[model samples]
Target: MARYLLKRLALMVPTLLGILLLSFAVIQFVPGGPVEQLVYQLKGRGSGGEAAGGGSSGALYQGNKGLDPERLAQIRKDYGFDQPAPQRFWLMLKRYARFDLGESYYHHQSVTSLIVSKLPVSISLGVWTFLLTYLVAVPLGVAKAVRHGSRFDAVSTLILMLGYAIPGFVLGVVLLVLFGGGSFWQLFPLRGLTSDGWAQLSMLGKVTDYLWHLVLPVTAMVAGSFATVTVLTKNSMLEEIRKQYVLTARAKGLSETRIRYRHIFRNALIPLLTGFPEAFIGAFFTGSLLIETLFSLDGLGLLSYESVIRRDYPVVLGALFLFSIIGLVTKLLSDLCYALADPRLRFEGAPA
Candidate 1:
């Protein structure tokens, strides 16, 4: 097992390098640079002289002429934006060797520091959503499977299907309208991490306040993922119920509940475990993009969206790389989990 894990870990380096190269190439070839994005933002803010008509185009050109040309060149040189694509690629590769992810042009902050600061919020949201998804989904799925063809099963199936069909953003909007639209019906807060005066609370009060703010965003994020887990669990349990071991266990005078829970449910969960990593990682990053945006949560997804619009290559690349690494590692962990859960997967000379 250790050897298998080490081998998988070793393969990640090349895979990550390939991803970096492809990402870098795409970013480099995309229209507009960081400077263009800066200029566009400045113009939008009514700061650009040309946009504001504070100076004629020729005067602006002459003003640029008076600017220190060497300093301008040095800025480009320092960023490697002046270098050719091939040269810049090599420079980036060299920097990667030193674990330097570069700096954000817009924020003027180290990419690492920026991501680190934002990561906790995303992780906090993801963790809560994941917990809620599994806690609700697994039991609901088991109930549906056990009571198959009953009214309970039918209603649950219908609800799960509807949840799956609806987009997360639409769901978020519906939730917002229902809970946050009116003063009388307002059960949930609309935005931000906490209500005003939260900081003045006692420690327990602070914790309660934090949880109160988390409820809406976490609910919005969990809905789609919960549906997915429910469906998968229901299907897996249904299949496990039909298997011969379940019947044999019942025939051996096992209690109905024991046969279902101990024999069937345990085996049924193996397939779900195979998807656990994908579900967790997807929930952590991809699942909450729309929900986060709708709720105005400052998460990695929100940051990445803003970075892309601003053409912040360093921020975009850094976030993408971090997400990719997480996904790869999760996949690796899932494989190990499969081996641990199923004896068939543990054979030393097993076929690849």
Candidate 2:
């Protein structure tokens, strides 16, 4: 197992390199990059008033035209564009090796600092989504399985299917329209994780306000997520109930509840466990963009999107690096979960 783990970890180096290299290449090739933006800055005609370097607006120029060739060359050299792409990539790799993600071009802040500031919102959303999903899904699925073809199962299936069909952002908009201050019921806050007066609120008030703002966003996030787990649980339980082992347990005069909970439950959990790593990491990393934007939450997902739009390469690349590492590690953790849930399972080439 240790050898297998080491081998997998070793494989991540090349995988990570490939992902970063491809991303870097794309950024380099894309137009309207840092150099062009800087030319606009120096010309002082772009939408953004001034560039990061605070270059003076000397003349109105378009697309580097009418700009001094020397100044243009100097801008390229200063931004390290003078070097070949390979050399720049290598230098970036070295900095990343030291865990130095560098500074954001637009934000004028270190990449790590920006991520740190934004992480709490994502973590909050992710945790709530994860907990709500599993806590509700697993039990709901088991109930549906046990009572298959009953009114309860039919109703829940219909509800879950409707939720699955609706996109999260769309649900968010609907939620806001119905519950936000502007509309029908006005049951929830429209944006942000807390009220402006959060710091001044009492302990209980703070908690209430936090959860109050979380309602729409969390609901939107988990709206479509429940079906997969719930359905998986129901189907797995149904399949387990029919297995010979379950029948054997019943023959031994075990109660129905004991048979279901003890023997069938453990086996049914294996397939569900396969989804754990993905759901876990996804809660933290993926699918935050539209939700965050719609609800006005500042999270890593929103930050990443902003970085791309503004061509903030440092933050963009840094976020990708961080997310990739987390994803690879989570996959390994999922394999561990599989081994734990079913000892019969083993990493390939490991001793039986």
Candidate 3:
């Protein structure tokens, strides 16, 4: 296990380098970058302020002309755009090596600071969604597997299918329209992680208010996610129930429940357990964009989206690098989870 971990960690270096290189190369060719955005903003202000203050056609045209060459050059230089792309890439790598994520071009805040500020919201949303997803999915899946072909199973399968069919964002919108401050009912807050004056609430009040605000967002996140795990669990258990060991246990006069729970469930868990790491990590990062936007939650997902639209390169690349590292680590953890779930299983180099 130690050797395997060391080998995987060593391989991550080149993998990360390749990912960074590809991303940086793409960013280099992308239009409407920081320099262009700055120039556009300047020209827009010139056109708006001057024309609104009664400037003539020639003046408006001149305002539209854009920045002087020296000013443009300076802007480019300040953004390090004047350097050759390769040099800039190398410099960026060096900075990252030293753990310096640098400052945001537009916000003027360090990329690390921006991520730190936003981490809580993402963590809150993610943790709740993760806990709720597995907590509900695993039991529900076990029940479905045990009662397959029954009325309860058929009905639940229908409900799960419907939920799986509807996208989380769409469900969020529907939920908001139904339960939010919309005309239907105002059972939930419109948008936010907490109500105003949340700090003033008592301990129980704070917990209530937090869960109150959490319901819609977490519900939305968990909506479609249930199907994958639930179905996998159901199918895995069903497969296990039909295997030779289950038949032998049943022939030995074991109670149906014992055979199902002790034998089938334990064996089925290997497939289910292996997915926990990825799902847990993913719950924190992936599939959060629209839900955050709908709920007005300022999470990492929203930050990444805004950075991309605004061409905030530092934040984008910094987040990309961090997320890539997380992804690689998650993959390793997943492998570990697999081995932990089934002791009989062995990797290529693992001791027999």
Candidate 4:
């Protein structure tokens, strides 16, 4: 197992490099990026601060027309844009060897600091969503499976299907309208991680305030992400319960309760357990995006979206690399779960 893990960890270096190279090639070669925007801003500022006339196009033209070759070259040199793409990539990798992620283009903050400052918020949101998803879905799925063909099962199936089909962004909007401050019940806070005067609150008060603000965003995330998992667990359980092992247990005079819960459910858990890592990754990365954006949660997804629009390459690439590493690590976790779920299966060097 140690050797297997070492091998997987070794493989991650190349995979991580591939991610960096791909992101670098796209962002570096792409036109109309941060450099161009900076040029336009500088150009507009060079005139009377109104970019030849007023709008963006006028500013871009004036900026381009006004800049001398020396100034252009200087600008490129200042941002390291003058270097070839390969050289820049090499420099970034070398910086990482010293544990630096460089600085954000616009913010002038270290990319590592930016991500670290925001990590707690993102992790809090992610952890809550991950816990709620598995805790609620597994039991609900089991019940639905056990009550299959009944009205409860049919109604739940329909509801879960509706949830699965609705886009998360659309669901977020609906949630905000109905539960947030809008035409309906203003039961939950509209946006943000805390209320005003949060810093002055007592410990319990602070905790309460924090949870109060989390209500809308977390609800949106859980509602958006749970349906598919629930349906999957239900289907897997139902399939397993009908298999010959279950029938054999029944024929052996085992009680129906023990046969279902002890034998059938235990085996049924294998498939779902294997998917745990994927579910966690989705909950943290993709699932959080639309929800956080809609509800104004200051999570990594929101930061990533903002950085992309602002063309903060350092932050963008930093976030990308971090997420890639997380995905690779989660895949390793899934492999571990696989061995735990089915003891017969083992890694190449795992002890018997």
What TM-score does each of the candidates earn?
Answer: 0.87, 0.93, 0.92, 0.89
lDDT of 3 by residue, 8-70 (tens): 999999999999999999987665566666665677653222233332333424444745888
Task: Tell me the tens digit of each residue's lDDT in model 2 across 1-352.
Answer: 8888999999999999999999998886555667767677667666433332232232223546888889888877977789999998999999999989988888888899989999889989999999999999999999999999999999999999999999999999999988886568889988889999999999999999999999999999998989988999999999999889987898899998888888898899999897798788888777579999999999988888878766678898998998899999989888899899988887875565
Worst 10 residues of 1 by lDDT: 47-56
* Candidate that would win on TM-score: 2
Clashes of each: 0, 0, 0, 1
Model 4 misplacement above 4 A? 45-62, 285-287, 349-352
C-alpha lDDT of candidate 3 relative to the true structure: 0.85
lDDT of 4 by residue, 144-250 (tens): 99999999999988887787777767877887899887788988888778888999999999999898887777766777567867887788889998899988888
Q: What is the lDDT of residue 68 in candidate 1?
A: 62
Ranking by lDDT: 2, 3, 4, 1
Measured by TM-score, how close is model 1 to the native structure?
0.87
lDDT of 4 at 281: 77
Q: Residue 22 of model 2: what lDDT? A: 98
lDDT, residue 26, candidate 3: 91
